[model samples]
Target: MSVVASMGRKEKAQGAEPSIAPLIELAGPDMERVNALILDMAGSNADMIPEIARHLIDSGGKRLRPLLTLAAAKAFGYEGDNHVKLAASVEFMHTATLLHDDVVDESEMRRGKLSARMLWGNQASVLVGDYLLGQAFRMMVEVGSLDALRVLSDAAAVIAEGEVMQLAAAKNIETEEAAYLRVINAKTAALFAAACEVGPIIAGSAPEMRAAYSAYGTNLGLAFQLVDDALDYGGSSMTLGKRVGDDFREGKVTLPVVLAIRAGDARERAFWKRTIEDGAIEDGDLDRAIGLLRAHGAIAETVSRAKAYGEAAVAALSATPAGPYRDALVGVVAFCVSRVS
Candidate 1:
């Protein structure tokens, strides 16, 4: 049940065409409106906030948060302008998190460019992130949906809590799996749930359908994060648009390393103690750690968990009617896992 091996999708779709093309194609029509809304939401008037805010936005993330909103809304037959505002709000919140995350993680690069904190300094990054959150809240209010606003507000709170938890857990090798789930569920899954739920809420969908979308997005976020954890310990750094071994260097307990710590032999335990626990591993330590992960089946086990989450994401779509949007939603989860692996 290695994560990559357990995904139930047909192969060869990964060959010539991008696995996410179907999702991108299905979401193409809403792109213009989404782009326009994002710009409007991002456009702000603060002394230095706009510069800090624009740094990562210009670095070109895929805006998958908004895409999730649009796809879910389309699946449920939403044809209103409110969805646009809601989608833009989700993007704004996501960007704000990235800004604060860089500051907290003390990250130097993001999306292969200097982080906002790097470009504008921490004070500017923090202020600008706050400004963006304010703007996102404004848009949420403008949408005139109490449910959507509450969802976003709670998500913002949860995201902050998750960040704090991660900061506390840093370099602490004994951090539990439950702790990891708590951090990721808030830091990652909250917004993802809001992104999908906002669409259904705007569409005035059935309760079951709304719940389905939330479950789908939540599971997808968890899967997305598991793959990310695996990649930080497993993927080539240059290919991932960031330096390799960042989590290791920072002493973060990503899934692969966590599994390796539990399942690895004495040498592997020594590697974790030196690199992760002691924070004193040298050159090739990262490579050797990755090697151990592969040899001990830790990486495979972690990915299997990711794939199970992916399968749950796919099954969540069963509550939605059969449509291109539904298939694309399922496909995106697979693509999210594969793209990282």
Candidate 2:
């Protein structure tokens, strides 16, 4: 069954399996600190900056990235408050990226509501994003760990480069799978890796432990993005937050489309070009695209790839000392892959 169907059945039935509640509960106390820091830092002398920042920050997000940071720190028994600052920094960076991404993608909605650029003008969104970046840097510096600073600052640069690469690849149906992976690694996975790594660094763990956590986050992030791409075509708006086929409408060259195009015939190739490259889509084109993906087994294969990454993420946790926090991290990997069921 598709993930949406499975979740629907659970929601409608008794004795449903648990979701990520355990992970959330494990990180609850620290997450409250992280949330408080986020709100405090989001304030500014300029009211508009805070207004725009709060609009997106206060949106109903899972806050998964920051939670991962907290979870990693707690797993290692870190005794300091630096993790709170770092978690807040991670969230600020993520929020900044979303604000800028919506503007770049010319997206109409975010988190099932009008995007900040839609409510405020694009210029306001862009400036507020810059402000958020500034705030993120401030928080990172306040942590006063050069290693942590290097990791996060490098991720920020890589993420910007990835966005540019994605822009170059956009609407290009011939974009290769390797190139697509590069985009996602830098765009999405780098921050996840960095977020996890900062925890061990702040905790004063050894290099090997730090590397393991980073590896875990990177693989988990790959799995997370792949599921999101698959859901874009297969999931409902209720499940996916944004509309179904948002990636298709934006002509973004995600993995499922990449596999489908490589396996597609000449007629299918022409169809992809007309819609994705030429932006000449008509009604029912999304249905045709989904049909092509399913016919080629692209969706299933993509999910298979995600599961492989998910497994790798689980394996990366092997060296960490076993505890509830470690178990919660493992559960997070399951949650990441189960988004597609």
Candidate 3:
């Protein structure tokens, strides 16, 4: 039976079974080093802006974004201080995006606590986010790789475009899978692709290897996002750092909702049309939407696609020489598709 048809019949975690433990083990020392650098970047300023920034940073996120950058660099055999600086910069870029996202989405809570916007208001959240972005750029420039700067800048631009695309897609119920991919690639995977690509580019690895990490990151990011979309319909608010079904509440047509709209029969279609398009979702809309998602097979379809794409991500790691870093890179495939939160 399709996963959608089997919903309410299966364990909740089974719906999105990504295992971060393996990824965490693989990250090891590098991950700890990552924490220290991020703390340094945020500093200890005792002000609302800094407090908001620090609050968000200390919210116990997985910190997978910059970890990918560092792991990819190490996999390519780059033993230098430059990657560390660049990795921190990349993380700042990601955190800045989150801060801005919360503000843009008008989110009240994050990681089970008040969001930066919730605590300090939207203006402070927006400006601090901008500060993080500026710091990211400043650090990137110091790395002295015009190549890195070019890639990161382009990624940032793409992220912005993707966010705009999603904003446009929010109220539109006819969103296609292609459009969905474009939005996610721009908003989330653009940086993932950049993270992996720069590893080899900075290390002076061959062109093929550079391309491999780039592809790997892109695929991993795609898989990651697909799982995330599914989880939004089911995962705990505390775990996802946002309320469950927040996307739906915001009028976004995620894969499940899109597919449900496409595959649902006449009556089901009307429900989506009313809820997703007409913005008439009510108190019980979440349960009803989950039912629609199952009826349309969108949930299972999304997971199937995530698994396939995750496999492709691991395959892209072949260009890296054999080693623990390579193994970790490859192992991320399992992590991507199976992640629960």
CA displacement after TM-score superposition, residue 280 of candidate 1 (Å): 2.5
Clash count, candidate 1: 3
Residue 8 displacement in candidate 3 (angstroms) = 23
Q: Each model's C-alpha lDDT? A: 0.80, 0.89, 0.78
Candidate 2, residue 45: the lDDT equals 88
lDDT of 3 by residue, 26-70 (tens): 666776776677676676464665677678888877777777888
For all candidates, what are the clash counts? 3, 0, 4
Q: Model 1 clash pairs?
A: 2-304, 3-303, 3-304
TM-score of each: 0.92, 0.95, 0.90
Compared with the true structure, what per-residue lDDT tens digits does model 1 show for residues 1-341? 23334443345454442266777787787867877766666666664665666667778767888889888888888887887778778888999898888888888888788788887899888888887788889889998989888888999999999999998888776777888888999999999998998888888888898899999989999988887777776677655567777777777887777777777678667778888878898989878988888887877777778888887888888868889888878778868777655
State the displacement of the C-alpha of residue 283, model 2, in Å, after optimal TM-score superposition.
Answer: 0.8
Per residue, candidate 2 scores C-alpha lDDT tens digits across 21-99 of 7779988998899888888988888888888888887768899899899988888999899999999999999999999
> Which model, 2 or 3, shows the larger lDDT?
2
Error of 3 at 62 (Å): 1.3
